[model samples]
Target: MEISARNSIKGTVKKIVHGSVNTEIILEVASGVELVSIITKSSAENLGLVEGKQAYAVIKSSDVMLAVE
Candidate 1:
């Protein structure tokens, strides 16, 4: 798929958590690294996301803030 985002990371779906309105997707980008994303339940179903499915995490943002406590 073609996308405008430059930070697209390819990974495999590791885990899925379904909520009433949203679904949490955990993608393993590296051997020990993962990214979590929350998307609409319908969208997740439409995409047919399941464990072991390959996906891309396309990040498009103007600013990313980091905080440490």
Candidate 2:
């Protein structure tokens, strides 16, 4: 499939936390770096994301905020 998002990282599924409606997916993009994303539980189930599974993190955001203390 074609996507406009340029930031696509190949990562492995580290963990999956399922909530009532939304599910949190933790993907290890790099050796020690991880990216987290929240999607609908139905989507998660449709993808069949399990621990140690290989997946890609497609980042297509309009705005990103960062804070430092």
Candidate 3:
């Protein structure tokens, strides 16, 4: 994967929540932080996302708007 952003984190797919419309993919990164991404059901099916699969969570600092305590 191309590392265009400094906030990019690589991890494995730990769990997947396939909703009726959209699906949520959970990834476990090296720092023990979990990254959650929402994608379309069709995209999830096409990508064949499952647990224990390696994936990259590409994140940009600008995309992250807010964080809570």
> Largest lDDT belongs to which candidate?
1
lDDT of 1 by residue, 1-69 (tens): 888899999999999999999999999999999999999999999999999999999999999999999
Ranking by lDDT: 1, 2, 3
Q: Per-model C-alpha lDDT, please?
A: 0.98, 0.95, 0.87
| Residue 30's lDDT in candidate 3 | 66
- The C-alpha stretches of model 2 lying farther than 4 A from their native spots are none
Candidate 1 local lDDT, residue 25: 100
lDDT by residue (tens digit), candidate 2, 7-54 = 899999999999999999999988999999999999999999999999
TM-score of each: 0.94, 0.88, 0.75
List pairs with backbone clashes in candidate 2: none
Model 3 — TM-score against the truth? 0.75
- Stretch of 10 with least lDDT, candidate 2: 1-10
C-alpha positional error of residue 20 in candidate 3 after TM-score superposition, expressed in Å: 0.9
Q: Could you say which candidate leads in TM-score? A: 1
